[model samples]
Target chain A: MSEKGLLIVLSGPSGVGKGTVRQKMVESKLFEFQYSVSMTTRKPRPGEVDGEDYYFTTKDKFKEAIANGKMLEHAQYVDNFYGTPLTPVKKMLAEGHDVLLEIEVNGAMKVREKMPDGVFIFLTPPDLMELKDRITKRGTDAAAVIEKRMAQAKVEIMMMENYDYAVVNDKVENAVNRIKDIVSSEHVRVPRVIDNYRKMIKEN
Target chain B: MSEKGLLIVLSGPSGVGKGTVRQKMVESKLFEFQYSVSMTTRKPRPGEVDGEDYYFTTKDKFKEAIANGKMLEHAQYVDNFYGTPLTPVKKMLAEGHDVLLEIEVNGAMKVREKMPDGVFIFLTPPDLMELKDRITKRGTDAAAVIEKRMAQAKVEIMMMENYDYAVVNDKVENAVNRIKDIVSSEHVRVPRVIDNYRKMIKEN
Candidate 1:
């Protein structure tokens, strides 16, 4: 039996260094991970590549995909349809490439509903204070917006129980290594190996 | 919010190199692992040390421990009582040391029944041919005994589904590394980290 790849759903509160950790994981090339390119009806900003940053599409096309059940999980954000495409993820899994979907907790929950077997991981800062410090260091948001974000983070932290794994993003490299180890270990999980072993033993 | 150590129950079919992998892991010293020394009523062979190889004990004391629920799992082989003591495992876990229990599938199942949260891992050879080769090279068992073992191995292989993880013992070092990765990854599991995070977040 050929081994199938894992569908990993990674979610966290904003400013938890999810992007940085994910970037390090990608750069490490320790494991074959295919990032799920999302479909968005919103106009791409400068420097964003179509089908790379997102599957940029018109609102009509996005709605049509949604109607056809092509989207694994979808949400309308600020009047723009943002959703994960189902076809690409399935194709990648069939090719034995672990697919990572880095989305918000709400989107991840929706994906979990659609695919309950997927590994759901939550990334968090060392602590709430550290998280606030990171957000403050970004220097892009107003004080009021930062406060709103911190409030939202607290709510997300409360939902940590729903995840299968919680990785602390203390150091970018360390977090990347931990996630890599997790991905490697998951390949040898009993259910996956036993599926292949059953056939091998029967032949023997 | 202190992290408690994991009770890892490792089991495999015969000739899967569980002892060699366990030795490599212990020698690596990557993590604090306390091997669960079992109490046996059998006479110690050459080079065996008390408390290091086995806690050599009297049959009366072994039976008394079993009656008092001190034994995690016990089995009688060749009229000798072989059992794992639960007190030492509990003490080691309380001291924040990951405890590794290397036992047969039957004994591992008993440990699982007592401690359901413990991680149960199954080790296996690459294939039945490799397993037969390893058993043959041992030079201890006769052909008929080896054949009997192969039949027993088939029965044990069927129980792989009950394990949480399965590491294929192709190369001894590779299997040890995979098990180490699994141990490291399990430390960041959601339930364990969330318990710590809950306390940390509450203070913040």
Candidate 2:
């Protein structure tokens, strides 16, 4: 295939259901893409496959991989190293296979540095998405509680500025559908498919 | 709603089903947007009410409006003048209402010069969309036939480079669906929605 694979970087603030939305997208066969398997120091949870769910690794090996710059984006959560192997992801993309990377905000920022052209999507929190409704309900909520949420949403909005598209995680299925449309729309974008069309012209 | 509306401009080469796709999108109620009424000098057909379909006007009046620069984009087709009124479309967009404008490539280019921020979608021909398939069938058709089609497709692709998205008109329903997705995805784009979000933070 002459078409190059797009690196879809999906990230958002914590508790925005990034993992759940990603899982639903894969389950629904929303878009055809290979997952950039994350290598984690934590032991596999029940029913989690070795290479499918995650590449289970030891702390020392993970540290070595990080030291060697093999990870595309790596981070520690609860004393466990979680990262995406850079080479495998690059290999899949080169073969015209889109790679879906679900990383935390910090890790996504790192990926942005390495892959500036990637399609970066930010998932917005449901509460933050309903700011208009929340404004209408100002009389119901405590002033302190409302102020705290508004402050948190402000920070998330700042993080979202780094992304190209933002999807509200009000519903997982709806979010996946939006992403499916985005991927389809991206495929036909003149900038992405122009080269492939150009190749066809040249060959003939 | 505090959100500003988008100007969705759909155009393509002749015989690319641009009208069919636009009609389908409206029938499906795919996205909430006002239909931009086009002013024309052509006599209304049976059951085609003025203002609903077209604002029927005399040739002299149409020419005077065009001379005054009131038309956003106008074209003369078969001795009849057809053009869009600039004031209404701008009024709708200013009131936070999206407007869909299906125009010819030349008129679209004119609109682009005036409203560069509009979402411009180009409809590609089905034959051109399957350039790969046709490549395999290169031997089946006469060389001249193939060359002619390729030349036409090349012109269309060149026109497409001016658009933001290219949807192949293989199926009218599929094209409408893709457009629906694009509109939904476009709504949450950070650049479009960030100001509304910024307002929320400042208000509290």
Candidate 3:
């Protein structure tokens, strides 16, 4: 049987270390996963390459793609549209490359609706105090904005049960290892193997 | 939070190298799980240690234990009653020691029903031919008995999907590692942490 790609959607609160965990996963190179380059109307930061960090786009172009159904899922955040494109993901999957998307809770839900077979993993902070500390330590947002984000975080934390797996970001190594274990363990699930066996038996 | 003991139920078809897997797990000493000694009515083989290999008991005493609810779960096999006792398991759990019980499918089911929180792991032979080769290589069972076991294995194989986790026994090291990862990963499940947090918050 041919190897099939996995569509993994990771969602979490503001500072639960989702990006760090994803970075570790990419460095490990244990699986064939391609990170989805999101299409966003927001301008790229310094040193961030176009089509690598994101597909930097205009508001009209983003809206046009959304209208044409070229985007798998899109959302407006801070006056900018961010979305995952379908064609690239499909092409990667067709070439047997697992795809990973680091998105927010709302975008993850939309992706789940679009691709029912996709896997979802939600990262959570070890504790509320630690979560508050992490958010404050970032020092990018104002106090009011941080409070608003924390309030939103509580709502996001409640949605942990909705994801197929939840990893608490207590430590970077442990969390990354957990994600790696999940990817490996999921590959050997019985249904997938049985399906492969059936196809093999048919070929025989 | 204090470390809690795990009740692990391990079941697999014959020739799946479950015994080897358990031996390696014990060797690793990663988790504090001990092999549970089952009470059996069968006469002990020469050089077998009572209370080490099994708790050799008379048929009447075995039946008495079942009637008195001392036996955790029991089944008749070839006119011998083999069962797990509840007292020692309870004591072990109370003292924070994880216990692993290697039993047949029916026994595993019974334990799962009794202890709804128990972890059930199903080990599988990589394929039918490999299973047959391993069984024959054992050279203990008669041809008729071997055929009977293979037939019985088919029934057990069908029930694998009921298990919480499934590991294929292609390589002993891989199987043991899978079980180890599963045990470690399960302990970090977010709901359990959330429950502990909720309890502390309530107490405060």
C-alpha RMSD values across all candidates: 1.3, 5.7, 2.9
Predicted candidate 1 versus true structure: per-residue lDDT over A109-143, tens digit per residue: 98998888788889988889888898899899899
State each model's CA lDDT, in order. 0.89, 0.83, 0.81
* lDDT by residue (tens digit), candidate 2, A1-204: 367788999998655778899999899987899989999999999999999999999999999999998999998888898999999998988899999999888889999999987899999765554653544365666767666656665787687788889888788998999899888778777787766656655655
What digit string (tens of lDDT, one per residue) describes model 2 on residues B82-190? Answer: 9999999999998989999998888998999998878889887655546535443546766676667567767766777788887877788889988887787787788
Candidate 1 local lDDT, B1-204, one digit each (tens)? 477889998899988988888888889877678899999999999999999999999999999999999999999998999989999999998888899999999999999999987999999889989999999999999999999999999888899989999888889888888888999899999877787888877887
DockQ of each: 0.84, 0.42, 0.30
Error at B8, model 2, angstroms: 1.5
- The true-versus-predicted C-alpha distance at residue A141 of model 2, in Å, is 21
Q: Which stretches of candidate 1 lie over 4 Å from their true place?
A: none
Which residue pairs come into collision in candidate 3?
Answer: none
Those runs of model 3 whose alpha carbons end farther than 4 Å from true positions after fitting are A1-3, A68-70, A90-96, A197-204, B2-4, B90-97, B190-192, B197-204
Full candidate order by DockQ, most accurate first: 1, 2, 3
What value of lDDT does candidate 3 attain over all alpha carbons? Answer: 0.81
lDDT of 3 by residue, B53-147 (tens): 99999999998999998988999988899999999998887677888998889999998888877778889887767787889999998999888
Top candidate on DockQ is 1
DockQ of 1: 0.84
